[model samples]
Target: MISPDAFHAACLGLGAGLALIVAIGAQNAFVLRQGIRGEHIGPIVAVCAISDAILIAAGVLGTGALLTAAPAAVVGLRYVGAAFLITYGVMAARRILTPKALESADPESSGSSRSGRAATLATVLALTWLNPHVYLDTVLLLGSLANTQGPGLQWWFGAGAMLGSIAWFSSLGFGARLLRGFFARPASWRILDGGIAVTMVGLGVGLALGT
Candidate 1:
């Protein structure tokens, strides 16, 4: 049986993890889009959850402290992420003007093909890794929080956080299929793309300006 202290730590970690990740951000937005498209949902969700697990583990291992000392590295990532977000935003905006025909979520669909899956995988990775906020939130904040649970309980806390990440990504990726009918409409896609473009560009500007 798990000890009371360990259980408490795990609960705390779970709550913190969910709180941090449930926000509507670039990463979540991309995941939602891919999920709706019904393309590479498994790989996309796996990448997100696995990436979070790795980052949370690193933080619990004290990499958060190391990152804190390397302000320059964070700044570099910020700018790079900003550029990528803005570029992607432009692409999304272009899609609004020149939308493609709504394709079914067939295995043979262009988006579900091997090359397309590869591109989607790359995009998800970039969306996860490039964002400086992820490092700050997952590595620094969550790591520090884990350490506070004391050595014996820190791992439990990290495990809880990891569980939270897995559950969330699974729910988001798999649950989005329920809305496939709504998104099947080209008008709905245009609206979604418009919103994505605005969100991406806004975030990019904020990151670039260090706001």
Candidate 2:
């Protein structure tokens, strides 16, 4: 049986993980868009959850200290992520301008070709790994919190955070299908892409400015 201390640590980890992830950001936005389009949901969710697990484990294993010592690495990631986000935002803007790029929300009509799947996987990987905020949040912040749980229970805390990541990505990717009816309209896609463009560009600017 799990001890009360272990359970409490796990609960705190879960809440903290959720709090960090539930915010609307580039990663979540991409996942939501893919989910709504019903494209590669499995791989997308798997990548996100697995990436979080790895990051959280690293943090708990004290990699956060290494990261802290290497401020230049984070700076590099910031510029790279900002560039990528801005480029992606411009692409989204192109989709808005090019009506031909907009497609029906029907899963059957979605891009399911091999190349499309490969591209999607690559994009998700970049979004997960390139974001410096992820390192700060999952590694530095969560790691500090987990260590505070004491050596005996830090792993339990990490496990709870991993569970939180799994549950969230699963729910976001799978639950998004429920909104298919709303996205069925092409105009709705335009609006969604518009929002994505703004979000991505704004985030890119913030990251670049180090704000």
User: Clashes in each model (backbone N, CA, C under 3 Å)?
Assistant: 0, 0
- In TM-score terms, candidate 2 sits at 0.98
> What is the per-residue lDDT of model 1 for residues 75-154, given as tens digits with 9 covering 90 to 100?
99999999999999999898888846445534346356678889999999999999999999999999999999866999
lDDT of 2 by residue, 1-211 (tens): 9999999999999999999999889999999999999999999999999999999999999999999999999999999999999999999989988977788767898869999999999999998899999999999999999999966999989989999999999999989998889988888889989999999999999999998
Compared with the true structure, all predictions reach lDDT values of 0.90, 0.93
Error of 2 at 178 (Å): 0.9
Candidate 1 Cα misplacement greater than 4 A, ranges: 101-110
Measured on C-alpha atoms, candidate 2 has an lDDT of 0.93
Q: What overall lDDT, based on C-alpha atoms, would model 1 receive against the true structure?
A: 0.90
Checking candidate 2 for backbone clashes, the offending pairs are none
